[model samples]
Target: MKNVTSLASGAVTALVLSLGLAGGAAAEDFEWPRLLVIGTPGTSSGSFASTNGWGPILQKETGTTVRIVPEDSETQRYRRLTDREDIAISSVSASEMRYQIQGIDGYSQTKPVAQRILWHHNDTPWGYVVAGDSPVKSVQDIKNGGVRITQGVFSPPMVSAVTVGLPAMLGMSEDEVAEKIEFVPASSYAENCRSVVEGKSDIAYCSPISSVLSEMEGAPGSIRWLDLDPSDKEGWNAYLAERPMLIPAEIEMGVKTARGVNGATSNFVYSVPATADVDFAYNMAKWFHESFDAYKGTHPLATRMSMDQFRKYLNRTPLPVHEGTVKYLREIGQWSDEDDTWNNKAIETMDAWIAARQEALKAAQEQGIEVNFENQEFLDLMKEKTAGVENFQSRL
Candidate 1:
């Protein structure tokens, strides 16, 4: 990936630099859409990097004004893009995508942001780091030692991806694991890294793919990632069984820090919600595929973009592919009978989850619990009860 001139121009196209639409792919131009509003993670994130670069290019290519709106969190961005009343598109973290689709974890109380997959880019490992000077070098050390870990309290990617996955992998519950490590919750990754450097936290849950974490590694206090026990099949099974978005990752030279051989998480995903019109999504995706090569060199992560990664993760089952994406896949001969089967299964799985969501809501109301889940209490309750979520798992 090329060096970004601005914070908004990071490698996420690399993922930020990484690149994405649909009607079975587009045959012609889309009409009726005067403006295409794009939602992305805040100003300095990888998603923002892509937005910052792509907006201008898209405008130049299509002769349309690209309004890139920034949201503080992935959830906020997803909410805006998925809102029927809003005219916008969003790029989201795949980690959060899993939770939002399942209506579990941090999204338990929120409405499902189950939109179509149009574009994909950026695949980074997910995990945490300890001070390079610290003695902790493995998951077991952090799990068994009196290590203090910090993460975003309400952030789904942090909470579900690391905050909770770490404990599950250790064969303990969150409360039980709390006895060994002090859990420090922060509002942002910058704060998490600051806490780590100041000795307030022994570890900060992160990945090298993040510019912030990469910067943290270069700060006064350097850090190293904890290696998971790759041979621990039970542990790996338990952790991944809950969160399927992550695949095994061995990150050596990352966005900032370098890693040794380790059992980290990786996947080729960086996606935007394709909820726009079929023709629009198709044409949009088509243009992106064509323009992708022009921007991949703008950021480190952008340089990681490839057609192979796109084919592998773009159409992962249970995450519906937009018509526009389908068209592109077909045009490239990437679509196959196997994909058709999976896509059908994905539709079935989604139906089950959507059905379960309603069932869960109705059950909550019958027990005097309002279905309106805007607070922590309701979200927690929904996760704990599992009411209708169980049904969907069987379908999956």
Candidate 2:
């Protein structure tokens, strides 16, 4: 009986050990990370269908469990992600990232937040869109003394305000350039297009390559995009020098308008993703940058994702290259030691400028020097200076 009891105890111990080993093996074999994706919601008329957007593509590529949550507005998206640090977000603007990082604007007044940006995808150009029947032809046409322009409420307004400053820098006023231009606060791009089609608005600003433009193009006579000339290449290049991720992109024929209107491609800023985490961001960037061909069957636009274009875009925004991205670039011989030295210098210069500006602003405020204008100027300078930095930091 003693021997029998001892044998039973040994059997139970062995069984338990076997079960634990099997569980460990199963755990080691599991290879998916729980990923959360947040972005602007898709529209029925737009090309951002759930199956076609970056979210699905990312999941397919990474073999990770992805949960895509769409927000009604960019502000809301930012709020949710910032408020809940555990949730990861994508499709954030560089400016938004800056605001969050520096605690500027509403974020500054509300709460301090820090975020890691993974990678930049594209530099989205803000387009000035009009109905196909409108007499407005070019950006100069809008500036010809009394043209009424309509800018959408959110992202468009911010960009238009900056562009307004650009014209001011060139010796023009909002009234002089856009005499009757009024801002129409629409809920969505679809609503903006509808307003234009109904003649309730003249021109609405949006991205030329965005799903909204695609929908408007199909609407026939309802919407047409005005081309911003690359003639301001010097100014644009200066902007690009500061913002490396922004490339001089030409809207190809058939993408937006019919042939013969311009006969030549129109130039604009293209958006790209950025990240701070060198390894993760670079890995994400490298995967998308190299495996773009894999998504050709998914979207025709994917064909444009070429290595040459990637290099061009990178040249436009030379922020601290995410380490992972750098590793890939170095492997492909696209980067060199010289590039590293230049990037480090650029970073140092930017940091010094930011510190000096901040100190000056503080001193001016303490002296009661009516620093409102100075504050505004400082903010604008920061906007232009750190556009690429915020994006790079987000990935980290």
- Candidate with best lDDT: 1
Candidate 1 residue-wise lDDT, 206-252, digit = tens: 66666677666787767777776656767766776666656555565
Give me the candidate number with maximum TM-score.
1
The TM-scores, one per candidate, come to: 0.68, 0.56
Model 2, range 1-396, lDDT digits (tens) per residue? 000000012233311110111211232243334443334333441223422445577777677544544454645555554543323444454554544445455442223333433344333455456788988776556455455545446555434543463354235665555553455566666676566666777766555555656677767675676654556665454433233233344545344463223212111111122222334444555666666666645654444445665565455443444455567678779888877785565455435444544554565457554444335654554455445433332110
Q: Could you tell me how far off, in angstroms, the CA of residue 220 lies in candidate 2 after the best superposition?
A: 6.8
In angstroms, what RMSD does candidate 1 have relative to the true structure?
Answer: 8.4
lDDT of 1 at 370: 61
lDDT at 394, model 1 = 11
Query: Per-residue error at 181 for model 1, in Å?
Result: 5.1
